[model samples]
Target: MDAAAEPVRRSPPWRDLLAPGLATLVCLAILLALGTWQLQRKAWKEGVIRQVVERSRIDPPLAPPAAGTWDPAADEFKRVRITGRLLNDRETLVHGLAPGEAPGRALQGYYVLTPLVREDGPPILINRGFVPTELRNPRDRAAGEVAGPVTVTGILRASEERGLFVPAPDPQRGEWFNRDIPGIAAARGLTEVAPYLIEADATPNPGGWPRGGQLRVDLPNNHLQYAFTWYGIALCLVGVFSAYAWKRLREVA
Candidate 1:
């Protein structure tokens, strides 16, 4: 065959590449979109983390706003001080997991939610802190329950919604799966209770049973890593399609 005069090699037919080309384009679009979405999420998550730190770390905590006065979006995680008598007798234990002694281990336990009876406004629910499965009973940690007028300084939190997998609370057994504030108030025969809970700070109690400071400020932020992963996959996909198209065109030629 003459080098220049012989029949010139032609590219693959449009029909042959159309379906795969369209499929590849669709996949690339999805992958790129996912990666971009992750970057946006990264920015949003960073803002949330910053807000939590700023709000929760304010010194000389302010008093909580009255009913219908506070906006949860604006006031959540704000450091607040409330002085009242803790109704230890009506405390509710919500199931949870706390950091164990060893690293990367979790201890099965419950958060003690007790009502703080203020003199003027409605009583507020305070997440006193975590207690292991062994100290689930108030009697076991009786001395820790300080009586009389007491002041609590901690981060304000909104009511927690139950997860789909979470079971309904056993009122008879006084066991709760999640922090349903209204349910706890009703069960405790409390009226006009505050709509939020306060996660107490790391202040040591007398008996040192119900450990305080359970706010999970350090939220998992792996969106950037996820974005890179998606982009990497998209790049590999493009390289594979290019190789496949090149092979097909050469075969036809």
Candidate 2:
């Protein structure tokens, strides 16, 4: 046991020496299983995309099945038609939205949320889309009338929340924008408001702030991509393990 080769110390478990060939095979098997799982996920995501696409294509012949805390199974993706007058008097424009509709590089606007009183029941909140900041000041909308019996065709959508970065709005001071249906209905003095809101189809609005009807359905099915990355890492690990084992076998020989 010279100083250069002082028994080439290794721990008890490391020196025990499991079969490298077996370990390499196990690593390969694990990688393949993960890749297969990813393919399955891709199929599932594709099915979801198909369902949503088909739902949006149809006309609003059928009504949304009652109004409550939105059952995804019962009410989501289905088309509905509502004919009612827009209550411009009590409408609350949630601030901050602009597709750069007008001049001045700043895009400040409000989403047009008017309470549409259904003939039989309480008023339902209809988001008519976004309007410019100039139109949202109440003074402008208060003067303009969204009068008469108008028809609206759009998809049923749930109200959104302010995320960690975005805090809940203070409607009293008019300092925020999010489609909080409960908060919105309270702020606008709208009684019997529907729990859900409609993300409109490509329809035009008057004041031209929010550029309404921009209902985007963009969801990526990237399970395959993700799986590929993970499997690639597994492959690299297997390759490295194989090379190490080969060197060890040569030294043992």
Candidate 3:
């Protein structure tokens, strides 16, 4: 047969690609959605970081929120000043780590969370700071215990959420694995306790037993990296689908 008269090769019908096209579109939509969501997350994380940095740098702390006006979301990381007497006898020891005197080493310690009864509002938990494991006994750090009414300035923090690996608190032994404000309040028989805890500043205690100022505001912002990863996957999927479609078309032609 003459080449001109021979049958003209044509690409596969559109119907043949209906299933794969729909699936590719669905996958592409999902990948793009994930990438967009990560971008939103990145913006949210940046805002959060900015708020923390700005709040931390401000001086002349504000007064604690009055009863019925406390909002954990708004109040967290806020520096507040409170004048109250510490209930040293009823202090709770939460397992923690403190910066050691030497660099590159951490000392195992417990956060000394003592109750401070504010003259204006209900009692609130104050993380007086980290005490060495050996100084767990209140008697050992008697000098650091302020006698008269004291003023504490620190950042307000919300109760921590327990993780799957977090160990349960031993109320009987006064051993706490997490900063569960409610649980600690109930364990210490505290009435009208604040919902949040105050992380005390770096004011030197008398004996320097409990080192304060351990609030770490290092939040990792990797949303941009995650967004790029998702977008990369989407590009790969497009390339693969395009190559497959081109090969099929050439074969049909």
lDDT of each: 0.91, 0.71, 0.89
Task: Point out the higher-scoring one by lDDT: 2 or 3.
Answer: 3
What lDDT score is found at residue 80 in candidate 3? 85
Which 10 residues in a row give candidate 3 its minimum summed lDDT? 8-17
Give candidate 3's whole-model lDDT.
0.89
Task: Please provide, for model 2 over 140-204, each residue's C-alpha lDDT reduced to its tens digit, 9 standing for 90 to 100.
Answer: 65434556787778887777777787777888986656778888888777777778877655555
Clash pairs detected, candidate 1: none
Scored by lDDT, model 2 comes in at: 0.71
Best by TM-score: 1
Task: Go through the candidates in order and give the C-alpha RMSD of each one to the true structure.
Answer: 4.2, 5.2, 4.0
TM-score of 3: 0.85
Per-residue lDDT of 60-118 in model 1, one digit per residue for the tens? 89899897787899999999998999998889999999999999999999999999998
What ranking of all candidate models by TM-score puts the best one first?
1, 3, 2
Which 10 residues in a row give candidate 2 its minimum summed lDDT?
Answer: 202-211
RMSD of 3: 4.0
Please report how far candidate 3 places residue 199 from its true position, in Å.
Answer: 0.8
